[model samples]
Each structure stands twice: as structure tokens, then as C-alpha cells.
Target: MAATDRAEYCGIGIRGVAIGIDSFVWFALLFVAITVTGVVTGQVETGAQGVHTSLSGTPGSIALGLWVVLTLGYHALCEWRFGKTIGKALVNIRVASTDGSAPSLGAALIRNVARLVDWLPSLYLVGIAGMVLSDRRQRLGDRLAGTTVVSD
Candidate 1:
């Protein structure tokens, strides 16, 4: 195989913005889905007093399942197929294999699944720490998946 040139990794600043955008997209989707599901199932009650959401029983289970699938699938599928999520596209960055190819499905899954770990203790504090500490500007997911976030 031919040797690939090193990638110019994106800084935490831009990456942060990209993730912020992506977070909004996926979380919004999840929120809407769960909200509609709750209302449709009579699990979400709104009155003059306040709004109450009951995420228990079948409806709760469905919401939980949707949360897991949508969160994981959004990142994994987008990176695997398009090399970037909506947020990354907006910021003009992309995730690519260190070998200078598009990230494979396996790689995207590994990275996005690892996102659970990266999200520990707060809003991506661990991921930010990883990016700060690593010379390659990678979070845990990127390192495990052998991928990098680079200029598009």
C-alpha cells in the first residue's frame, strides 16, 4: 500500500462548534420523537398548571429504545456514509480514516459507540480533555476507530 500523508487535524474550537451543532440536531430529533410519542400515547399531559411527561410502561420503553438507536445511528451512519454529520458539514470538517480513506462502517461504529465513554461526567468533558491531550486532536472515539477530524 502507498504511504499516506498526515492529515491536518482540526482544532478543538471548530470541532467544538461542529459537535455543538450536531448535538442540537440529534437531540432535537430525539426530543421531538419522544414528545410526539408521549402525546400520542397519552403519556405526556399538559394543563394550565404545567406539562408532565410520564416515561414509564410501554411508552417509556419505546422512548428509551428510540433514544439509544437514534443517538448512535445518527453519528455512526452519517460518518460511515458521508464522512461528516450535519454539524461537521456546516463547519467544513470531516471524519476520515488515518489512512486517508473514508471511514468504514466498522470504524464509524467503533468511534460513535465509544462516544458513550467520551460523554462521561458532563457535556463531552472527557472528549475535550482527550482532544487537548492528544497531539492528533482526537477524542477517545477517533483514536479507537483510527480516524481523525480534518479540514474538508
Candidate 2:
């Protein structure tokens, strides 16, 4: 491949860094939401030892559902509308169709949804392996969605 062709594909290290940044964002959101919910619902209780937090029943269920939507929706909306997440944008990478065009919503959804499989055997072992072995450096989700993570 020519230099430009090679430049179009992002490798594992940068992708991993992008994901790490994304995870921090997710964690921060989760922490804020949980803290706010605990405060509003009085889910945090003072224990003999120290401060404690607990949630169950309706509140717990609602939190769980909302988290799922927010987590998935964050990726889907970002990819479909901008072709990249905040992390990917910061890292100067993007998710694009194999044909080098922006991915459609359906394609982006497929890519994000396939994360379930990509995470198999813990910590994306399979997905990492696939990226390392594939010519395009794609994960399972990228392959399934007919997309690639590229430098921008």
C-alpha cells in the first residue's frame, strides 16, 4: 500500500488509547449519575463504619436501564452523526465504511452492538486478536459492520 493508504488506517495502540479515553468519560458520567441519584433518592446511608451507598428495587432498575441507553446511545449517535466519538476525535481517528465513506446509522449501530461479541472472553481478547491479525486492523465489530477505524 502507498503511504496515504497506510495513513488511512489507525493501528491498535492509538485505538486502544482512544478507547481508554472513552472509558474515562463513561466512568465519569456513571459516577455523576450515581452520586446524583443517591442524593435525590437518599440511597446513600450512614453506616457505623463509614458512608455507604445502596440501591435496589425501582431506583436500581431505572438506573440500570438508563445507563444502558446512555452508554449505547452515546456511541451510536456520535458515530452516525460525526463518524467518531469524543475520544476518537481527540485521537484523530474515525470510524468509516470500508469504501471510505461515513458509515450510516445502521452500520454504526451494527458496529457498536457487536461490541458484545468483541468483548468475549473478557477485556476484548478476541477483538484485539482480530485487529492484530487482520490486514485492515479491524475488530470483530468493524468486520461485521463493514467498517474501519481510520486516521483523519
TM-score each candidate.
0.81, 0.79
lDDT of each: 0.86, 0.82
Where does model 2 exceed 4 Å of error?
A: 1-7, 32-53, 57-62
lDDT of 2 by residue, 29-135 (tens): 67666666677788887878976667788877766666666767788789999999999999999988887778899988988888778889998888888899888
Candidate 1 has which clashing residue pairs, if any? none
Q: Name model 1 segments beyond 4 Å from true.
A: 1-6, 35-54
In angstroms, the error of model 2 at 11 is 2.0
How far in Å is the alpha carbon of 50 misplaced in model 1? 14
Error of 1 at 151 (Å): 0.6
TM-score of 1: 0.81
